[model samples]
Target chain A: MSELLIATHGLTKVYRGGVTAVDHVDLEVRAGDVYGFLGANGSGKTTTVRMLLGLVLATEGGIELFGEAMPKAGASVLPRVGALVEGPGAYPHLSGRANLTLLDSTDGRRRRGDRRRRVGEVLEQVGLDPADRRPVRTYSLGMRQRLGLASALLRRPPLLVLDEPTNGLDPQGIREMRELLLSLNRAGTTIFLSSHLLAEIEQMSSRVGVLDRGRLVLQEDLATLQAPTGLVRVRTPDLSTALRLLDGQVVDRGEGHLVVRSPDAAALNAHLVARDVRVTELGPERRSLEEIVLAASESA
Target chain B: MIRVELVKLLTRPRTWITILALNALPTLVAVLLAVTDLGPRPGTGPPFLSAVLTDGTLFPLAALGIVLPLFLPVAVAVVGGDAIAGEVQSDTLRYLLVRPVSRLRLLVAKLVSVVVFVVLAVLAVAVVAYVEGRLLLGDAPATGVVSVSGSTLTQAEMTQRTGLAFVYVVLAMLGVAAIALFFSTLTDSAVGAALGTIGVLVASTVLLGLDAADAIKPYLMTRHWLAFVDLFRDPIRWGDVVDGVLTQLGYLVVFAGAAWANFATKDVNR
Candidate 1:
């Protein structure tokens, strides 16, 4: 991966009425790496993204983009960064082509042939047909997502920040978006994707950061974080006593059940037997990305 | 792609539609009035048409006396008042800001578009009213029916009066539109901005009506709203016209300056 493309230290945002949505978040995203920012709704992921793009004012701290300190948005830095902060921002009354024309003209990158050519390229990249000139309001949710993606790709920006780009997409559209993002990353563009869907992030991102309640709990590569490990669920006659004995080794699974992870099952059974807890059911549990994420979230 | 900011401006179809209706209504009403014989004829004057249209009385009703003072500026406000705040409500403002454009440029583009719409709407009202007046009342000589109070001017004088009235109305309308645009910056609800603008205009008009408050009337925006009234008198007074232009210009500068500052600094999270 290239050097750090984005770095922030002590970033914070406090809304009115004393709600501290984002609390002193520090993040580092390297160039050409697909970094997934994971968090549930209202967990400060969106707030941090907004601060980085200068859409919302940061309460405190420093942000550096591509090696330069960013006290505020600057012309030198912003033009090279493309983002879809929330959702589709295009005009509903204008056709998809007209929307692209407006964005292209603002940057003074104009040429009749270039406009048509670039629009075609971006439409193809986003899986939208350039020949269709219907207003964006008529597009489906997935199509709007594609249109937004096309807008972001118009400039072929080096740093692309997309928040929930695959939101509301069908399985096919989601797969296409995943592939498109990977292709963009392969071409040396750093991708910063914020989403609540860990499965999608697990499939696409090189690294993932888990945020819970306005705080970062863990930041690790997807491969390292998803290492397969067996989870052992043993049902006993006495649930309360089993949990008491294996205090630090148990994840609360409500309704008088506990999930314990261990490599040796025989040894676990012997220990439980010694405590007079009957093991009714003992089996190896498969650990999926969803379980791991849930465990991490529950632990946080 | 046209700039995202401009696209945002055009997305609200209701804004311009409201402006179109507001501008067209005054002319429509005037035309309807011209064709009808609602009021009594003066001194059994040859029918209502000869007294009102042919004698040039339609000039005051069409341009200065009523249409410009009440309707034109209010129409301008109806559109310009919702320019900024409407975006906040629709949540599209966030999308535009995320694009590479600065807040200042975005505000400038949106403000210019709103001003352009207001100007165009005002002009439409003026043209339609003028053409309709001329067609309905062409060349017929004035009879003794309509009250040509001693205060009434000659036919030629009335035509000049109408022309000057149009200029003053334009100036007053410009001031109203600027105020409305400023209020739009202060709020997120389109209704709040539009109603607040109209309410302020109405309040100023009421302020001008108070006999005891005459001293403060000269400084009020509403008092100067009828500065076009000066155009109706003989030997047209350029002093009120100049003061009216300068005052409207001053208000425009202040309102526009505040809008720029607020939009540039305010957080557009939407």
Candidate 2:
């Protein structure tokens, strides 16, 4: 088992007006895992991220990052973790390069001489032009998003916590961002990504956790959640003949397809073909991430 | 962190614009005094105003007097009030905190930046006023400046006292900065914090004029603000000057501590 990079035990948060933003959620993310955090609007994903980063104080329970208690060991632990919460924020009058340099200067451990170089490197890493001198106020939303990612990657941190990282990006920019994140993950950076876009999470996440109305409704590996359902889906012109041959094994029927309660799709296809039934398509039925999340939320 | 904060303060265009606005009033006063030669009746207007018509060297003091009561304090309140709250408003406070900058260090850096701004504004006013006084107003007599006590003060003595007054003015403005900073940490709106600090100063000024508030008058934040005038007296009246310094320091310690205590534990949801 890989070491747990982030662990929260019975974590909860209650606002001053008695609104529970995050209920008892025990989240665990191991090293090298691309953990996708999923939730609807106002489902406490951002609040939980803030707590993990020590921006918001937790009302109950505890959080441990890299094996040390958080918001207490934050001074030491945070330097190793990079984050972009909500969206990009920069001084409106400063160029993106200048903003990154200023933010880098806040960390005393970074050498002064290396700041400019590091800032340039991160800007290029995020597909931004380091020579662009326009103030951030004039930047397009996609440019600002890239700048935000550049800032988070400035120090080459071991972990990245990004909320809606791909927001405000065009299709091309989103694909670029996805590729960049995948490359970074392959290079050994743990990522905790929070978004409402299931497709984004489905494409990249190794493990997934879904939050619904202040509760962790689901937490499982993506592969496990998307595993085959021990049923076969067949599409054919001879639907009646296939159904008669399969008889009681047919669980569901559509216009030109049938869902058969069989574990082996190929064997079912062979049985139908030997009986003079032409099979157009045959495959095992499996759930998508969306279906799993919807079921989990409904059950919760 | 202090260096970074100072860099931020110095690089901002608003800082320079505010200092320019601060020097405007004093410069206008100098130009008007030079053109019309109508100085306020002795002791009736800003301290040393009537005297500056005769000795240009004394215009720095006159300029300080002109802006000390309202303009300088307002500028200080705006800058200090924006210290923390502006970060919150701009959404940069969380990024800074997660940079692993400790809360106490960030607060200290913010206070230092505000102090630097106060010093810069005060210095700019004094320097600009000196040039304006020399070029546009009467030249000082070869003998020396006449003290507030109607005694002659040597040039060296006058320079020393002017420097002392500059330091005192900076210290006085620090009291305002501390209060504004304390209020800044309490709200996410920079404008609201600035207005709240101004409100406190206005209340203090109102109570200072009321006889019914006499018992607490000595401790009022603005009560000792103009006591720097005593720095130019013949024998140098130290009573009010000392009290003023101590009072401003008292305000600084109390309000800065309050700001730190409140901000260190803030939820920072913004």
Candidate 3:
């Protein structure tokens, strides 16, 4: 098995006033995978991330990062993980470069040339000019988001945990953030990010785990889950021919219609047409991430 | 860690502005004393004011004395109060804590920053007053100190005692600093922290003023704040000054310890 960079065993967290924020979540993110944590606004996504970082205490479960138990090993484990929780919080009075430099000074690592050069490099990496002398308070919201990402990337660790990383970015900035994350993933960094934007996750993540009301509803690879979960219902005068062409993939049978499950519904339609079967209806039947989460939360 | 915090303190405009505002009272005292020579004689005014007019180097002690009652303590309260709460309010404490820095060390660094701020503010007022005193009051060497028993001490000894007085004043400010820092961990609002710390001091001072509360006065942080004045006595009355230093050191230990304890377990959602 690929090394699991992040693994939690029945991790749970219950806040004050008897509120269960996260309940028995057994989550896993392997090495070299962009694992997207999908959830609703208050579905315990941020709380889970905070627990993984040892920022918040877990009520009843265990969390291990890189095979070491955290928060006991938080000193050793946290250094190897880079995170951007909420948009980066900067000293509004200091220039962007100054803010990053101050944060970099706290890193316990070997010196790799002058610190100023590294600050400049990360600033340029995030598309922010290091020479910009304006204080962070003067930067636009998108600029702050970019600066937040730059701060996260400063350490260049093996795992990057981000919470709503593309929060305030415009479309162009979001695409750039997506590209940056993808490039980072390609370079062998395991990226675990949480977001409610399904399209963003679908486009970026290799595997996904959906959290609904403090519980994991689904966890699967994008490709594996891409297969249609149900069947496309079709009605036609030559339904018997369509049924014969679909083989044994039928999910439902009726008098003059048949329901079949297939990822390639277009290919099935072509096959039916080649056999001279008239088709009245055809479409893929799969639940969207949004609908799945909504259903799971409502049920909870 | 201290270096990072110092950089943060120096970079903020609010820091400089606070220092300037704190220094204002001393500058006014220096200017008012220079003009008209309408200074209060010994035993007629606050600590060290009469002696300050003759010797320029003595003005720093006088400045600290003038501000210590409420002005300097309030400045210390404001700086210490803002240290952690300001970061929490701005949400930058999360980034700082996420680094390899532990909560204890972070708190230590914050406390150190407040100490550094106190030193800087005191020195700013002292330096400006020293210059203003030298320019306005002329370079008269400090006169001899007359003891209550009619003994005299040299000017060099007087300067040395004044040095100790400045150092003691800084130590006194640490009591307020420690309390403010402790409150800083309790709330996310800087203003709330400042007010809370100052409120405790105000209540203590009020109790100190009440004879019915005389039994608890020795233990109160406010009681020993003005004890730095004892350093100027010809015999150098060490009794109250010693109690004052010990009282502040005790506050530092208790309050700073509590701040660390509270912050280490904080969820830090902000």
Candidate 4:
């Protein structure tokens, strides 16, 4: 029901050597959605991101950002969109502040006087020291990654397209980045995050799109993909008694547990308890994001 | 966008280092001439090398001649070649493009930056040579500079002609910049682009010496590089000067057009 901030109509890209990096992907990201684009390495995720940003021209089909035809209207539309593709890039010889200042200057729409304030704000927002005088070359990988994010956030655009945003980050840094992104999303910034990391997409994305071998193998809401199956997993101390009691309904047997073809976990547990079976752990069966993605990849 | 590029160029250490290297040869020559008090006999060396012994003001022209053949063009090639390819190498080109800087604007800014570098190098060489000539070489003869045609040149005429020669040398280097920039767009390696430009210049020089290549000699990129020397002749000959301008402009148009055609539609996968 919300507005679609990004929509691609059968977009595709084929390199000169006949390599189809992306094939007929109709990506749709609505407003206020944390769209997680999942793919394995070399599965055309980067190519799709590049096409969306107008860095790589699509060989066929079309792209629209904020409802305007993309690439053709990139000059006007891109100013409202921020992105970090592949990795962060900056002038190594320049200080972080200087690099951001120059990059910010590229957007002619921003007033010159407000640049320093904006740069400082983004640096602090990314947990970086705005006063750090060291050149970017001296910064650690994490610092450079943060700087890249800062550049993307400089304009406070309504949309952020970040590819592998948590890359090169230690656990603490990743946590901070996730928190920052979530806060931004809460403040009404739509996020299109692309990564091969399932755990990341699983945690933050409201909607998910999976790319496999240059094809959009699956696109659905994270909740839909992760919804409970019509089954219940039960761990019992008396495994034999539970198995005998639910012989025909038992679908899968694992280490110390049984998956029963029952929709209500409480009812299944009650039935087992009524038979004098000791139920240790019982819950509704739901596929993990990893399992879902793997299933999609296999089918594709 | 042009302003941003110029800021990048001016802030870069490589730019200053190249400029300093360019001035080194001319400065060293000035010191040697001052110490030994020996000048190659008139008409035997780079355009005004011998003339500088008695008239220091002419050293600027001599300095231009010293670097014009190789050093100046090499510097231009390096800077121009690095224009687009260097960004690609560092992974910044995509960021800039996605910053929504139009491909045309970026290309124009790069071309302008290269032109600024050419102008800066030529001007630096002339200024450094002027000081060295004043302090370490001779003052202008009281009768003023002796024109190449064995005629007297007033102070005003000498200064005016030197300025003209300066502009001409800058124009010549612009042709080199255009070539290097075109190559820059074709590859992501800055060194490759620079070397390719130098390779073309070297080939032009090699062919210029072979009578068998005479038919195309007049159109070679380096063909009229020395035409500025004629600016010193009394009642200056405009024939070669005009041809040199036209030839350089032709190269600029053809090569810059080729670079734009390739780059504007490039996939920018890097």
For DockQ, the strongest prediction is 2
Tell me the DockQ of each model, to 2 decimals.
0.27, 0.84, 0.69, 0.79
TM-score top scorer: 2
Query: What tens-digit string does per-residue lDDT give for candidate 4 at B1-270?
Result: 998899999999999999999999999999999999999998798889998888887898999999999999999999999999999987889889988899989989999999999899989999999999989998857678778999989989988998999899988877898999999999999999999999999999999999999999999999999999899898999999989999999999999999999998888888
What overall lDDT goes with each candidate model?
Answer: 0.71, 0.93, 0.84, 0.92
- Candidates by DockQ, descending order: 2, 4, 3, 1
Error of model 4, residue A119, in angstroms: 0.5
Clashes of each: 10, 0, 0, 0
Kindly list the per-residue Cα lDDT of model 2 for residues A118-229, writing each as its tens digit.
Answer: 9889988998875447898899999999999999999899999999999999999999999999999999999999999999999999999999998999999998888889
What is the per-residue lDDT of model 4 for residues A191-253, given as tens digits with 9 covering 90 to 100? 999999999999999999999999999999988988899989899889988989998999999
Candidate 2's residue-wise lDDT over B1-270, tens digit each?
Answer: 999999889889999999999999999999999999999999899999998888887899999999999999999999999999999988899999998889999999999999999899999999999999999998959688888899989989999999999999999987899999999999999999999999999999999999999999999999999999999898999999999989999999999999999998889888
lDDT of 3 by residue, A1-300 (tens): 889999999999988999999999999999999999999899899999988988888999999999999888988988889888877799888899889888999764647368788888788888999444689999988899889888888888899999999998999999999998899899999999999899888889899998988998788787677757756777789977777777888889888888887767788788788889998887877766566656656776
TM-score: the better of candidates 2 and 3? 2
Task: Please name the candidate that would achieve the greatest lDDT relative to the true structure.
Answer: 2
Docking tier of model 2: it is high
The list of candidate 1 runs beyond 4 A from truth reads: A109-113, A227-288, A291-300, B1-16, B37-52, B55-66, B140-167
lDDT of 3 at B206: 94
lDDT at A299, model 3:
71
DockQ metric, candidate 4: 0.79
- Under CAPRI classification, how is model 4 graded? medium
Two-chain complex of model 3, DockQ on C-alpha atoms against the true structure: 0.69
Ranking by lDDT: 2, 4, 3, 1
Of the two candidates 1 and 3, the one with more favorable lDDT, higher being better, is 3
